[model samples]
Target: MTFLPPDPPNQSPAQRKRKKKKRKFPSQSGFWTMMKRKKAVEEPARVCGPSNKVELDPDLRFGLEKAKRQLESLRQDLTQFRDRLISARGSLDRITTEESETLEGVEVVIMRKEQDILGLEFDIHWATDYAAGSRAN
Candidate 1:
């Protein structure tokens, strides 16, 4: 057997020119073109049904209104309690002021009663409770 390779076939000039033209003008089969055509033909529809609408029951509405009224009343009560507490605290502070009276070369320290101070502290505690209850409601 001969070890030489066979001679290749010679293509005509017309066939070579056609092949060159095909190479120059490549096929228009890109993925984006196909995707654009598909999107142009078929688009997804976005729609909501009647079930999405909100429906509030009459009892719930009434309850909400009642709760709102209660909240308003609680706020007013809390405000009144706070004002009373502040006034009481101010009066107690005034009573606690040191008053020095020199009677016959003897210094006298006149301390006020502790009952008003205790009463003011109690009012402050009650005001805090009123505020907490209002927030909880």
Candidate 2:
């Protein structure tokens, strides 16, 4: 092949060489920008998340109310049980005799009350969720 000069008198040798070696691939930034624009346009319209508002059936509403009341009662019972446990602990510390050994039964009672409170709390949460109608109807 023979080398060719620029057509215009003012055109430089580099310009002539560049014209011969025209780019086949777009620049990195331009390619990324185009892809981003295409992605934005081609994407589905913004998706809406789950709606929290739900209608509660009458039975479920009653159950939820019952659960709420039960939960409150359990919480109060828990506070009383905790206070008793604290007092028992203090009494045990003061009297390290066989009296402390007898207090073991009181510890068991405190633990059972705690378990009951936890169970009630769980029930309340479940009842509230059920009442909220989480399932598709």
Candidate 3:
């Protein structure tokens, strides 16, 4: 089934389109104004004279002195540490030398025991041979 509806009112065409103009920035105008103001002001001419001197604060100067003293103390401590380390290394080297000698002594004792055991075995063998010869005779 089809349903019929009443016709809607016709609308008029839109007006001619106008090209959008680019926006003028306020920063350029401000810059030009600042430039004109700077031109109007006269800059002071430089005179040849002694440069401005800055005085150090007394507290800052005292703090710097204290820091220098602390730095010197730290350096001395580092030097002492290095010296002690060298002394300790020397002692360690001596200990190692003594330990090596002690090890050599232990090795010599082990070798001597081995030789004694071999000698006893040889003596026992000779005694057995002598007894066997005496019995055969």
User: Against the true structure, whose lDDT is highest?
Assistant: 2
Off by over 4 Å in 1: 1-51, 91-137
lDDT by residue (tens digit), candidate 3, 1-137: 78745333552222211233455784898899987754332121111224322233354446545655655565566556545645776753554566557545655655565565556445434444444443345
C-alpha TM-scores of all predictions: 0.28, 0.31, 0.30
Query: How far is 61's C-alpha from truth in model 3 (Å)?
Result: 93
Clashing residue pairs for model 3: none
* Cα-based lDDT for every prediction: 0.44, 0.57, 0.49
lDDT of 1 by residue, 11-126 (tens): 66667667666454355567678778554422221113433322333444465456556555655665565456557667434432332122211211111223333454454444
lDDT of 2 by residue, 1-137 (tens): 99865478877877877878966675978989987965543232222246544443455457656756665676677567656756877753565556545455555665676676567556545544543443323
Clashing pairs in 1: none
Question: In order, how many clashes per candidate?
Answer: 0, 0, 0
Whichever of 1 and 2 has more TM-score, that candidate is: 2
- Best-to-worst order by lDDT is 2, 3, 1
